[model samples]
Target: MHRHRGVAALAAAVVLWASFALTIRGIGASGLTPVDAAFLRFVTPVLLLAPWLPRALRAVRRERPGVVVALCLAGLPHFLLSALGGRLTTAALVGLLLPGSVPLFVAVILAVTRGERVRGRRLIALTAIVLGIAATAVLTTAGATTTGIGVLLAAGFVWAVYTIGLGRTRLDLISVVLVICTPAALVAAVLEVTGALPVNLTSAPVSHLALFVVLQGVGTGIFSTLSYGYAVRRLGSGIPAVIGAISPVLTTVLAVPLFGEPITAGVLVALALVVGGVITYNVKPRDRAGSALAGPPPAAGHRPHVRGLQPHLTTGVVEHPAAAGQLHLQ
Candidate 1:
């Protein structure tokens, strides 16, 4: 694994997400709607990745193309649904439910589909994420809605699956973005055409549109998506979730200055927990003092494959296919 590259990817993704949250918060503070913002989300990516469309289309059509294309749907509706749900629900609920539970969703998917067990430190790190996200939610001055809860949860699930798919397969990032964003832009175009989601550039102040293109379009849509894919490509599936879980903290921190949001004791504590969890999650077995030894693996499926992670472990020594080295475990 290109460990450094993964770390860089994870870092870039986390920064983009944090910026995304901050932008969303700013939108919430204004009378401006996110419909146009959502529209821009899809369109920006389409334009940015236009050059790579042909190749990405080829990738999407190849080797489980349907699955890849289906996975592509994850990001398309997230912004729109989340925007609609926000109108129906509280900001706090939206924040807590979506980013907070995404990790659990990913963990379940990996365990059930990939048969990757969440044992030891992974579990501990996950628990910390849960706790941190919960704390952040409690500190948030937002509202609630029965319907909004469902929408946000669905959003969380979509993103989790999206993250998992990125790590699960070896696909070119640009191609995946092309496959995903093209249809997403089309969806937004449909909404605009139907007048279901009105987009009036003239009606909206010029300043708002500028912000939308800069933050929502370029930052969140292009940079965020590419960075996350890169991060997942590097960090694998686990720490990306950890990094994502911490985005709320970044939101809160940035929101304090940008959105005139306050930082409460709960916010401080939540930040601590989130930061701690990220640290813990990134701590590899080699980082710990004689890190708690992992046992052996089962006879099948447990053999160390260098390219990706495997499951059904007995916890003995597993040979790393790429490293061609032994993972010394308990």
Candidate 2:
């Protein structure tokens, strides 16, 4: 049976992520520095989701030690790097560039390392993502912060590795997420406590921290942990990837209308291209026979994987081989 629940979860992820852009705009309006903003974003999610620690730790104890370690290694760094990158770059640029980079990185790494052949539809989807992002970039100006863009790009690469790494592991849904998030939260909180943060939340910027709480605690800490796996179980791996293209478009559109940030021609182009790419990629060839009638793609049935470090940021369903306890490729 098609799982509508996964689709709903994916949709929620898209909305929450897009709202992330607006949240940045809100912080900007509040006159906080990007570092403080980024710190809060990361820290809040950890705090809000801290309640899950007991269960998460129990799951960790139940799972293989190596698998838990792998999850922490793969997922934690991505979030750490991405949060740092966001401090350097504009949220719109991050939105547009990050997600667009994942499939490309995944395909190349897979082909080279695992000997997995990249196929037609995935290739086309990749092409569409690039072209759409290019069009968006051309239409809008990200203010000549090429260095910032580079940082975000590196962050994206870290996330791409995380996504691929998820495929290699055999951990269950709760175990996998906890393994990733617990360490990430600890790391980020440590940084905050140690004064690595750019803006001092102790001063005038206290109000902005509340926004951070909302963004991380509700938007990421809670939702992302479950969304990817749910989508995978309900919809399928490929479908969520395609549907995720909606994130950049939705975020950019909402930024201006709701947050009063000016919308640009580039944003519009990006929106169109992303939608087009997603549609093109999701559609199957008529020549192929299938068991069920195609409607809007069903939800995937896997738990969410963190996307904090990628070019765009993310979550996805993953299924690991039963005995491998290692990363699996889709």
Candidate 3:
């Protein structure tokens, strides 16, 4: 894949992810217990990727023993809290707030722990994202369901922790996800088998259990994990973080149709600010002059290379020559 195509693929992944809020709402609309719904969502992914578990586990043992264990511990709160939040809140709010919260928290954490200072464009971008989120939340407050608003706030905090955890740990994508998910699956299964999960879907007329299979299994499991890995691999985590800025706007816009919610000027303005900030943050000064003269360009993809203590993994379908300074996976 070329650079442009890789970017398009990344965008498509976000769009696919954007669909998840709607799906989750549909499941929750059916009135399933949060635990039951969460159980299905968490376990489906493990089963879908179970075939690859051996390879993922081997990678864990080789490169990230401590990280592998930490994943389980870190993911417990991330999944459980978010799952509960989703069930208690509107899908639209939970989805939008979580992404909006990630960048701000990631910046703070990186600055404190890694000594990575937020500078120049990044600082501005971070500021704009924070302002946009505040604006949207403030404007939407009167209209937001109180329950949804409360749950979304909690969800945002949980997501912030997860985002920081990712930066803190050095682990392969598959291995880390597997480690996190395996334990989550065990806990959920325990709940279900112990009769803590209500199974009244037969009378409820909506089968959220079935819906969880698609939402977590296909959407969160395959699409989310692949998109995340590929995005970070090909473009670096910064690019994805920039692109994720639009997630809040995407969820809000999509919700207009899915939930019959009204779209106001506040949402559009917030989207504009967020998009502008992201562009400013990611664009290099020299690219301005080159961009005008450029015609069609090649797609961008993974060009793995040595970076710090970890071996960089290629993110997308793009491949590069050795001379380009990218390391080929052995």
For TM-score, the strongest prediction is 2
Q: For model 1, how many clashes?
A: 15
lDDT of 3 by residue, 1-330 (tens): 645654775676566556555555555566666556556666776786688789766756765454444345334454455445555555555555444444555566557867777778768977886776676667665543545555554544444444334434545555555666667777877877787756443344445556667655566555655554455455544455445545546767778777776666776665666555654554444454554112222134221122211111111011000000111111
Score residue 17 of candidate 3 by CA lDDT: 59
What TM-score does structure 2 among the candidates reach? Answer: 0.72
What is the lDDT of every predicted structure here? 0.52, 0.52, 0.51
Which segments of model 3 are wrong by more than 4 Å? 1-8, 55-70, 73-76, 83-91, 140-153, 168-170, 197-208, 227-244, 274-279, 282-330
Indicate the TM-score of model 3.
0.71
RMSD of 2: 6.3
**Candidate 2 C-alpha lDDT tens digits along 115-134:** 88857875786687678656
| Cα error of candidate 3 at position 21, Å | 2.4
How far off is residue 230 in model 3, in Å?
4.6
Score residue 311 of candidate 1 by CA lDDT. 12
Full candidate order by TM-score, most accurate first: 2, 3, 1
